[model samples]
Target: MNYEAFYQKSIEKPQEFWREEATMIDWDKPFEQVLDYSSAPRTRWFTGGTTNLCHNAVDRWLPTQAKTPALIAISTETDSERTYSFEQLHSEVNQVAAMLLSLGVKRGDRVLIYMPMVAEAVFVMLACARIGAVHVVVFGGFAASSLATRIDDATPALIVSTDAGSRGKKVVNYKQLLDEAIGLSEHEVPQVLLLSRGLVSTAIVDGRDVDYDTLRQAHLGAHVPVTWLEANDTSYILYTSGTTGKPKGIQRDVGGYAVALAASMKYIFSGKPGEVFFSTSDIGWVVGHSYIVYGPLLAGMATVLYEGLPTQPDPGVWWRIVEQYEVSLMFSAPTAIRVLKKYPLENMQKYDTSSLRTLFLAGEPLDKGTSEWISNALGVSVIDNYWQTETGWPILGVATGANGKKVPAGSSGVAVYGYQVSIVDDATGAECAANEKGMIMIEGPLPPGCFQTIFRSDQRFIDSYWKQHGDRWLYSSSDWGIRDSDNNYYVLGRSDDVINTAGHRLGTREIEECIAGHEAVSEVAVVGVVDPLKGQIPIAFVVPRSLEHVADDAGRAALRDALSKQVDNRVGSFARPSAIHFVEMLPKTRSGKLLRRSIQAMCEGREAGDISTLENPEALQKIDTIISANHG
Candidate 1:
């Protein structure tokens, strides 16, 4: 089906289409209206809905795809793999669900899941879905305080965790932190179902805490399905940082989520049961929920789940997993690619990536340099996609890069199967002409698979997304991008983060891409700082690949000079960085996103809020030192 026809069908007969799609699942109950757009800007798809996400993803697939492998776990250290069949996964999820219910978990109840890349972590999520409970999976690396905040918000009935999880060669004390977060909770703390990974230096299981193995054992004899969930029922609450504010919860509904995941999997993955679809996303994030847990499972495909860092044990860890599982569909972040690129290409040559049919990138926009490099290096085209916690899945992106549906560099490709996307000037809220950079917004309602709300912040949802625009349009993404003459969507950067100097708007991504193209540069992040001369000056924080060649001040200066020249050639000298700070590593969120705001804060000697979300918090101190040394 062509994109245009699919989009028209979705918008013109949205209700009928959604209802027809809902019939694809085995529902304990059916929905009333195919959709309820009466809410206006905060439109609800598949309104008056009734269904269970687990039943749709696992139960239905189990009957036919029972023997089909559903999950592939690549042990980070041992380099060994274990593939789980659909029947095996379904039974495990059922047992976990029975255990959860035994602990007082009920429909509409929330569960805090904090575990490593272990198989049980994935099971916990599907288990929640099986019993109509909402699962809030925090990244395994989150600090106690960060976990505390989320736990306090959702106030889950249970907290599923592990004693330890691997990161590189280090063992993270997950169980210890889980205790701390539970201790800090305002309400009666949720029970912690501890998985025995033995990652912690000191592990303990006391009252309100049971070993994950014991809990599963307790459910050794139960397989009952509590399928009372409705379509619009809250499946989970994934928290996201607001563009201009603090973190807000994005509520996803069971029915709508199932529909969206099915559509995305069938289209984005070009679904084939038993084929391995690997996405290196933390279970804490939305991508993990949509792709890692929901989408692949719904499609009855085997999804690879890795439990450690990419560089851990060795840089070739990811490549080895791909070869080990024959991962056919690989999705990861641009930052990861940048990291792996720093490693010797010979390392990649060690593995046979012939199984990889499609490569995907998200969490942030993909630059031309990385996209082109991946295309040439792996000989596989990168299908760079764009979406957010709000939209659920890729709303504006190329379906599959290997399908000869690729666009030019920088373009996020065209809108997905069923989305009406437009680039509009944020100042006027009017659609921009083709090739004009503007805020990307959706005109029609979101697909049924998108989030439902900001938890308790209905007014914030309206104010943040709706108030700026009239009731007619729903402002979704904070990204700045443009559509070319060929109708290809090219994402710039976040609107609030766009650099405007001498009235010419520049995206940080363009500058970052220019800086990354330099051979000396390993990874880079460009942020707009308040400038006395230009309204805002672009300052770059760079992590060089080889400190040996650029081992001294002279080498640093030479490297900066090369980067400056490259930026001048690519995006004009005016877009060149006011100054380049050489640091050991750029601070990144667990999801591999460079935290430019933190860099800007470090440059200004201000507090970098929520440093806990970072993978390496101490990296900021290095940035501070670099800034200090350069200024001195």
Candidate 2:
């Protein structure tokens, strides 16, 4: 296949080009048109086409290169490694699928998958696909109550999980959580498929559940092999990160997902056959579904899955994995970078990371501080890629840098082909000038891989994204960014995180950077707390290098004054934090981004649900104390 020719044609006539690309895979039936944009935000792709993702990702590859390495699992602990060839993966998935069939799972039935980064998790996902079951993957760290809510909501026929999964040296007991979560559910409970990694002696079995090993043995000779399905069917139901209310399940089709994913693999990762592409994000996140699973697998490249935090037993764990796997492409989050930076540089020097080539960052706004450090310390060029769960792949990325073009440190590079990117004022809905901050909206008929609708709430999806600026353009992102005269885009923080005081608009990230510039401050989180005087006032939660100084009122005042001065010099007086809470730590998500909402909730003395994802949940309690002492 001439991928380059297809990409070039896709840029010219996307609809027609995509129709052609859709034919590359085996389809149960053909479609009339590649796309129909009759509806604004909820356009359908491959209008009448039918194909299956499992056929392309696993089944097709099984016949040609079954002996080739398909997956590389790197544990967070030092020197934990496992590799599965296409044949091994095929056999595992086949056995799992047979077990699922024995348990009465049928085509189109939903399956809820909740597990850590273990290789069995991937095998389970593949098994679901093999048998035409729609799978929903929940992150392993989610609170049991939250996990149970999703399971009850989706009402899947089967739930697959492990007794325990290791993260660094810490063990997550998913079985206990699973039991507690489903204890109160009145809905029909799904049959449990359990994997006991190190808990063989402690295995708990029930009439409604089957042990993973036993299930595999029962299907040893019952392997029916993976078969192809139609493309237009539901591939999987991925629940979005629900910060608002209940997480909305986003249903994606097989054909569109496969086509859009192939483009992303080619253009975004510059992936070629047999290349090793590693992403640090867990399968729970959307990036993991696209880049880590479907995309690389469809491109005929090897995908590496890291099962633990970047800093487990040591800070150099990820670097060592890259050297050991010979990973050519690496993708991770900015939060991981910050955690690693806290470790001694000497620890990182012990590993050889020369195999890494292109480095990509996503999930949150990448600060220049981390970007520079990655480029200088790792000796790999860093590229910032932008996309949402709904956008499918890299709608905007630094594509030219695939050849080593040095883009300015902070820019997300120019818009990739097939996207019309612009920054516009929220109130007026007009494009903003160069260097002016505003909402970033992509003008498009909804592309393939974009979500069809927010599972049960069509109006919510429309109200959240489409209805913002008339009904013509789809507004999928809440982030703010600016384009320079050179047409390079620099992402600011989220629009909701933008602080407005005394007629001046300031980004929380800007204030954060200024506070971080101070020698005494270790880390900072800026939030617009409710105030009677100003509509909302910016507050700083600081993590000081030395608690001895920060614990005192005088020292706290001095540091606050210094941070105020720095903010004024860097951005302006309006951007300066009105109050600074010198605390032991700041609340953050597991992925490592500071949680402004958690801080806001704590400051307001409200509940912060599911702190299970936090690397340090206890940090929030300390923050609450500091907030109360200051406000009281």
How does each model score on TM-score? 0.94, 0.91
Per-residue lDDT over 1-632 for candidate 1, one digit per residue giving the tens place of the 0 to 100 score: 66566656777877766776666566676667777777766666665656787887788876687898888877764455688888888888888988888889888889988877778888888888888888887777678777777888888888888777766666677878878887886767747777786544555656777777876777885796757676777888888742333458888888777887886776676767778888999788888888888888887788888777788777887887788788888889998998887888877879898888878888888877788887787888688888988888987776652242668877777887557788887787788998888888887577777777788888877777753455466565878888988889988888867998877789998899888877777888898888777888899888888877468879878888899999999899899899887777878877888888888877766777766767887898888777878778
**Tens digit per residue, CA lDDT, model 2, 97-205:** 8988988989888888888887888887888888888889988878776787787678889888888776557777888888777785555775888887774234364
Where does model 2 exceed 4 Å of error? 1-12, 20-30, 77-79, 200-205, 225-227, 400-406, 468-471, 517-522, 544-562, 582-584, 609-612
What TM-score would candidate 2 get against the native? 0.91
Q: What lDDT does each candidate get?
A: 0.79, 0.76
Candidate 1 lDDT (Cα, 0 to 1): 0.79
Predicted structure 2: lDDT: 0.76
- What total of clashing residue pairs does each candidate reach? 5, 3
Error of 1 at 398 (Å): 1.5
